[model samples]
Target: MTAQIENTGPLTTEAGAPVADNQNSETAGSGGPVLVQDQLLLEKLAHFNRERIPERVVHARGAGAYGTFTVTADVTKYTRAKFLSEIGKETEVFLRFSTVAGNLGAADAVRDPRGFAVKFYTEEGNYDLVGNNTPVFFIKDAIKFPDFIHTQKRDPYTGSQEADNVWDFWSLSPESTHQVTWLFGDRGIPASYRHMDGFGSHTFQWNNEAGEVFWVKYHFKTDQGIKCLTQDEADVLAGKDPDSHQRDLRESIERGDYPSWTVGVQIMPAAEAANYRFNPFDLTKVWPHADYPVIEIGKLELNRNPQNIFAEVEQSIFSPHHFVPGIGPSPDKMLQGRLFAYGDAHRYRVGINADQLPVNRPHATEARSHGRDGFMYDGRHGGAKNYEPNSFGGPNETGRALWQPVPVAGTTGDIPAPSHAEDNDFVQAGNLYRLMTEEEKGRLIDNLAGFIAKVSRDDIVKRAIENFRQADEDYGRRLEAAVKALRG
Candidate 1:
């Protein structure tokens, strides 16, 4: 008798255990219907049913692409970040564009803040620049964040966003006036994500090998040029084709006409930040180009579309905390809050092993750590020591690899930053008002009043006009007139 050879493919199973039956399920008989007690069948169905996790709380509607970031100019003097060290070294990157204040099912063309986040797979590690198109944000402190977001989201009672509720909050919180103006202006509704600029809204820190630190703000200017839709046009598009932006991105990549952007940074010396005219750490303000000019650093291009939207895009995680060797966080309160909140949210939504997912996995270097399996961790570290300080050879700590230490000079307590003369939020916002041309100012007032008039309370509208009045007398007067006209 010939020796029977059993065929065995790579040993695999539902969870990598070897399976005995390939086709048949546990049953009463060979010809009988499958039994509920079939462990394999139950495992398969259970896994499939719970495959998807909760979507993002915000920026839920988004798309992603793979690309390369090439250093176009020398920026090594300011940052020791390896990706920007070489003049022409190309670093692999994954970029995602999203709309804030919209649910996963919401329209893409809505008047919302477009999230322009990028994850660079650098040799050091994955560095995430989680940002938005605009340079400024709505609120400065993390305390007001939930309230601010509530205004943008749907009404808790009606399940629909009410302009009255939105304007009510904005009027009460005058600090939001700056970002609110940007939201209703010509660039409010971007024609598509490709045609808008992306900014590292919060100032970040860059440290060189010399241990010299500089505050930096990133500006990714789209090569496609800035394009925006009129309010009427955006409204029609939102109703006509809600998925217009998402479709445009997918179609453009499929045709091989990749979108590109020039990455630039406005660098400020650390010593100068304390004496700058405006509060540099404030998230609701912008550092003017006249004081600190933007210097080009590199170029970002998106050429590859994701094969699986769910696994590649939906599960793809990005956080401001994911910094490489040289880049570090600033004193910006919003950025500090996000450094904790984002990673925490990802852990809750995607699990601790989310970094192992194909989309979020580091491509430039091996993710060597003592971290073992949590929920879905599948022995990524094979035969490797799972503890540090082991006599056996393992990853060792490098003290010199640490980033530049920022000077902290206040009593260590649960109190806020000491309020300086520049603590008032209205100054820079007023400066932005005065900078606008006559026509631009007119449009600004009209837009502000148009949105504010929707608030049912005249007293609240008056309060909002007073806040604008504090910025510029003429600005407040014009807005007041417009609101009155809106009421009439």
Candidate 2:
């Protein structure tokens, strides 16, 4: 539905403010090299100088592709979201997949959670589903976010990742047990980007036109099927080809072997969620399938490779807060924190009009806002009245276009945050450990020991083992034994 490139006139400053000269820097005198007081030269130089923003602290390395999402099953009863309203409607989408806890230069084959974020350009606007391969996270509360990220990042003293630092945080914050189990599992190191499930780990709210709200968790089941690399294979791949996952994604799309997933949602009614056994809004947990079964919604196919990696993929922005009319966020604390953090980061990195970037812009809807003339304004809203209540017609807010409001009732006072009922964070982890076959459990223990054994401090290693013991005695004992064997 896109038109060919039309003559948009000569390129100018980001604001469409015309520029007569940009090739040479202005100078005090023609013989003089340059002058600092030239505003135009300063604007161009300053912007060009600060063009690159800080890469994500985590999930820094990634690849993206353009695609379309086709509604294959009716989900109109659950969500009024147009992308899933009909059985045949198609919406343009862009999907970005990346590894978390790794730098931009890190190897793609490393054992870490893969971020699977998708931005759908629906008629309503952009809906960004920011998620990961795992269905759960390490922490529940937003308050612990910075401290938690610190452990995964480099050590302040050594300037490198330290097993002791990570374990110290994990053992202390017992809530991380569930996600830790998944991290050590075979799924942690996927063989390729194509062979893994993507989940909206946070429970979100889907509001119907009737104002009914449901707590929803999205699962994009890979049609390529789940495939994982063993530790040995992962190590070999890391050494042989650091960008294995990125290369795989680009090549697949280029060759027309498009990677696709069937979108499914596990939804819980709002009333039931109020009294559910577990905290429905907790990011570090999942709703059991028996309680809320998977409902198929649509299919997402990545059909087009990005023309320019830096312009289209590296600078692209995705956030959990970018919701359209039918979708809204839940009271999920971590999700709430990210709503602010992601947008704030984009503003810092790509400037105020990051949304104007072609990769981030909506496909069908024109952006209308009081915000004008930022670093990268695309001039799409040219000559249109920028202000509301204008003599000349300008875009106005539509009440019917608004999302169905979910009631927000709570005392405005400082209070202890809500915790999940029966919140023994280790139980589900123990269950996961028990479900693993003996061989799998052995590998898990070995993997834990492989990393933990690197810690120089004996106390740190013992403390980490104790944390595992809290989950399962056998788990702790095996890890301790493996560590000792590795030391020998």
RMSD of candidate 1 to true structure, Å: 5.6
Writing each residue's lDDT as its tens digit, candidate 2 over 101-188 gives 8888899998889999999998988999999999999988888889988998898998998888898888788888889889988788
TM-score for each predicted model, relative to the true structure = 0.90, 0.88
- The number of residue pairs in model 1 that clash at the backbone is 0
Q: Which stretches of candidate 1 lie over 4 Å from their true place?
A: 1-48, 413-423, 437-439
Against the unseen true structure, what C-alpha lDDT does each candidate score? 0.85, 0.86
| Error at 49, model 1, angstroms | 3.6
